[model samples]
Target: MLRKFSSLILIILFFTTNLFAQEKPEVQIGGALRFNYNLSSWKEGQKTRGGDFGYDVFRVNAKAKYKGVKLNAEYRLYSEGFGGGMLKQGWVGYDFSPENNLQIGLTQVPFGITQYNSHNWFFGINYYVGLEDDHDMGIKYTHNDENWMYAIAFFKNAEELRFGSASDVSDSRYSYDVSSSADGLYRNKEVNQVNLKVARKFASGNSKHMLGVSAQYGGLYNLDTEKTGDSYAIAAHYELNAGNFNLKVQATKYKMNPENPADQDSEGLAMTAYGAPYLVASEATTYTIGPAYSVPVEWGPISNLQFYNDFGYMNKANDMYEDSFMNTTGVLVTAGNVYTYVDLAQGKDHPWVGPAWTNGLAAGTPDAEWETRFNINIGYYF
Candidate 1:
């Protein structure tokens, strides 16, 4: 299947470029192929079965630029059962100048951290709550200089997979978001969101640092009430690099209020991802810290190794809910276009960490014990 698709794409590209009558912009196509191995503490049966190893993802990325206009897009294919395939991102942008730019379409939201808030495959608790590495249908403006970087965006909402489906729940995309499901766990939809992020980049001797603050607010449109509620989050973050060592820290507070119908609960939300939905506390405070060091290596086929430990914690504003925690100790090996990550990840009250697929981010189960997963992911990028 893949070979046929690749050949067809190449054949089309060959003809499309030749058919152009005028000078063309630069176009680049690239992608990555990856696989993963996993063993979990919670899955006693899996241990008896010698763990699971399988295909991960094959993705394509495309970029082009013509004068001041640019485009970027990515599409991904995964294994048969889980998160089969989706459009990760697609955006069009115009560079007003070297220091200013604008983007429209499905682009990353300008909130919390710019690209990522975690160094591991399993991201921080904030990610489960829809604050990190999130993309939406929006327009954004950005400014950058030697000492300052700033961006603001107005998102209509998360990218919709279906326009008029009878069911509102959808987990067919890349990022996690709160929406109503067939189970009727939630009824609020994200809409009219705005985000602001500002940062200062500076250096002190051999150390480089970045300090930033981010905030976002939006309407939570209730499907049942036909009335709009609201949600908001504020965050502060800092990063430091001294020689080969790096440090990252972030703190965030968020709240959600939905005009839920009388029968529904307003203190909780259902966040969807990976073809499933789970509950999350509507109000919480989250914190994450990560530190990493690099070691240059002369080993065969290996250029460098990065050792890191990341820790994240979430404290729910509702006293009835349990706190959530996650920690990852990992090493990344980089060899040219090949990269590998070996991680020992532990979590308490995390949905991904357990065998039961419980909604740990919301009310949480009683006596929630820690669960662990040993994971290795290898990818080759071109």
Candidate 2:
């Protein structure tokens, strides 16, 4: 399947290039390279430190605009092993007006804050809960004006295009078993997802304020167990930019309801946040807040510096289980075309945020109380 997809991508690229060559469409190319070094400590009486140097991501983005129609695509290569290479985004859109447009193909879902401002590469807890950078194969319509912006999208699958064997049910009771093999696509059968968001921006003196509401709903059928499940979330977000300081806050409530509770454990859906396990609970409420201050400076090989902190907390409906939370503090330093991030992160009862990250706990196991990590990331964009 992957080979076929690769071939299809090549075909599209070849045809599009040839077709656009005659029209002399505007073309632009850009990419980024990043590296990471990390050290970690676990609450389970384990300490580990390791550093590896490689391409965190090597992306090639191509865009062409002819008349009111535009085509944009990005292909990425990762050192972390993401099936050798993957399509990060590929979409075509038409501008009906300056404020309205329609996009189709694989694109980011319109939900939550579009871009997260985290000094740490891991971002906030929302990323772990499928509220951050979640892409899907879908069509979306968007409208934007001076003060108001709105978007709605419909997705055939929530994450990837699954075209393989049925999922394994051995751990179905503990978490979502979307595919039988790890290499297979991670998605549910007969799934449909809808995402919508509306925002209003207001300017007050030197500060800009944005308030938004977002919602997502999805229904899936488990091919392996012949069972069905549904999930939904409602969120509100606010952002304020004053002078050189910026702040953002968001709260979301999500619920995963299964056809048969006995068929699944407390952990509702098995999701990933940047390749890390982010299990959505049966019912949970999460909150995230970030504040940042930027300082302009001129020094040797340094242009600017920003200090920021991100905090997140997730409270489960079942108090019997511990709450999940994370705190990250870091600084972003910019030098010419290169950027650097230094971060210190700590978390409790959160798998992805911890050093010993795991998909989900065993059916009867409990999460560790605490974990810590320090990370440094360097990236260059061109």
Candidate 3:
């Protein structure tokens, strides 16, 4: 499958370049390779550390505009075990007016913050709940002007394009199983999802502010268990940029309701958390705040640097489950198109926030109190 996909992409690129060479359509190719060295401290047992070097992403992006019609496509190559080559985004659209257009393809869902609302590479807790940086097979209509921006999309399948087997019982990491047999309510398998977002921008002196609201609702059905799942989220976000300093904040309330709650294990509802096993929670509310300061310095091979901090907190409705929170402080150094990150992170009960030792810990484990990690990541973009 990977070989076939790679061949297809090469063919597309070949045809696009040769066929449109005379037209002089815009074409750009770029990607990034990231290396990580990580150290962890666990609350119990032994501490662990490791290092990995690989290409984080290799993508080909092409865009062309002729007359009033526009076409865009992006293909990404994933390393072993993740998947092979896949279509990250591909769309064709036409501009009816200056401020309005329509696009159809496998694209990003209009929910939460579009470009990610976190300073850290791992993002915030909302990402685990399918509210961050999620893409779907859908058609979207967008309108943008000086003051207001609006988007609405209808998705047929949340994440069905990746490598996976059609069988429900397939345990392959890339399988299409919507819900885990051990837990219910935490999944991105919802179909026919309707997502919408609207935002307004305001400028004040040297500061620019953007405030937005987003909502999503979807339905899920498990053919194996003959059960159903319903998911929805309501969120508000605010961003402010003043001089070299910027601040971003978001709050979200979400719910996942299962038709046959009895099928769930003793842990109750399963919620997705980065780097951590499925979190057990009925309903959840989460908030994230990030502030960053950037400074431009003249130095050989270094153009700018940024210092930032990200804080996130999550509260679960179930009393049996304790609250979770994460804090990350990092410095991002940019030299030309390359970026380096030096970070120290600490948290409890969440995967990316905590040490590596706590990953895959069963629910209600006493040793899952707190963990810490220090990481250095170097990435070069082309």
Candidate 4:
């Protein structure tokens, strides 16, 4: 199946460039192919069998541009059945300039900075990007300049990712059927919800400094029966580079419903904040920092070797009651290398992960709170 898709995309690109190059502004085609695997090590007491090995996400994206109009299609295959076998993302966009662009179709909700980070596997230090994945079908707009950038989106509340299927309320005791029409697409079955996001970027080349700030809000409806919670968050990240050494810092403050509320006593969908991190117990906030260094390698087929150690501490704060929220923290050590090829580059990154330490933190599940996680992948982005 993967081979077939790749071949089809190549064939389309070949014909479109040769036959329609004059008619079209340009059709540039490129994407990344990533194969990710996780190594899960049991904690002091916890034992789980299914959370180990195999590819987590296998995705391919293809894009075409003609004049100011652009088309994009992405397909993702997963090893686990957590989110189904295969999913597709297709969208159309119009680029007004290098700083202004707008796209509408079935794309992800722009709610998290980490979620937007490249999925090249070798790009970041953390094993996991965030608490939840924020993706949905929507129309998105983007603007980028020197010091400011923003994204505005409007999504269909009916086909929301959090509430995948309304007809088959498997998790909920209540049963409801989804409408089979376009009107159902925009209609918020329970509570009407929308998202608003804005961000700014600051950089100083002389000092090799980069910084960003972002905030967003996501509202939910039918808080009782649906039990869907709303969320808001603000986050910031900064990076500094000097010679071969690098330093980075990141922090986020988010508020949302608890993952497991004692009073609620029900299983409901969670609302993710601006950083795409799950909000719980009225709210959950976290902060993280790390430093890394890279050294040019003279070994076989390796360009540079890099390593970093980072730690994250997350907990519930404010409006504290007898809620089922707890503080979770993780320590990580990641190392990887870069390999350059004729027309592509590949790299592998993995982290020695520690368990989520929750002792003396708060009230919540404490099932063997520790485990080792591995994330390694080979990717080619053109």
Top candidate by TM-score = 1
Per-model TM-score, in order, reads 0.92, 0.82, 0.79, 0.60
Candidate 3 or 2, higher TM-score: 2
Report the lDDT tens digits of candidate 2 across residue range 1-382. 9999999999999999887666557888888888877666753332322543445767788888886689888877764443345676788999999999999987877877776634457788777655766666789999989899899999876444434455332221111222222332233332588989999999989999889999989875665455667878899998898999989899989876655335445354445323333344557888899999999999988988999999998888875656788899999999999999988888887665564344322111265656777778899988
Q: Which ten residues in a row have the lowest lDDT in candidate 3?
A: 168-177
TM-score of 2: 0.82
Q: Is candidate 3 or candidate 4 better by TM-score?
A: 3
Report the Cα lDDT for residue 121, model 3. 67
In model 2, what is the error at residue 17, expressed in angstroms?
Answer: 23
Better of 1 and 4 by lDDT: 1
Per-residue lDDT for 1-382 in model 3, tens only? 9999999999999999887666545555566666766666753332432543445556677776765567787776655544556666677788889899888776777887767778776666666556777666778898989899899999886445343542232222221223443332333345678989999999999999999999988866544455657778899999889999989899998776655435444333333221123443546788999999999988999888899999888777666666677788998999998899888887777655564322221233445666677778788877
Question: Which residue ranges in model 1 land beyond 4 Å of their true spot?
Answer: 1-23, 165-167
Ranking by lDDT: 1, 2, 3, 4
How far out, in Å, is residue 144 in model 2?
Answer: 1.6
Q: Candidate 3, overall lDDT?
A: 0.67
lDDT of 3 at 8: 100
Q: Model 1: what TM-score?
A: 0.92
- Which digits, one per residue and each the tens of the lDDT, describe model 1 over residues 229-291? 999999999989899999989999999998888888777887776677778888999999999
Every model's Cα RMSD, please?
A: 9.4, 9.8, 9.7, 12.5
- C-alpha lDDT of candidate 1 relative to the true structure: 0.87
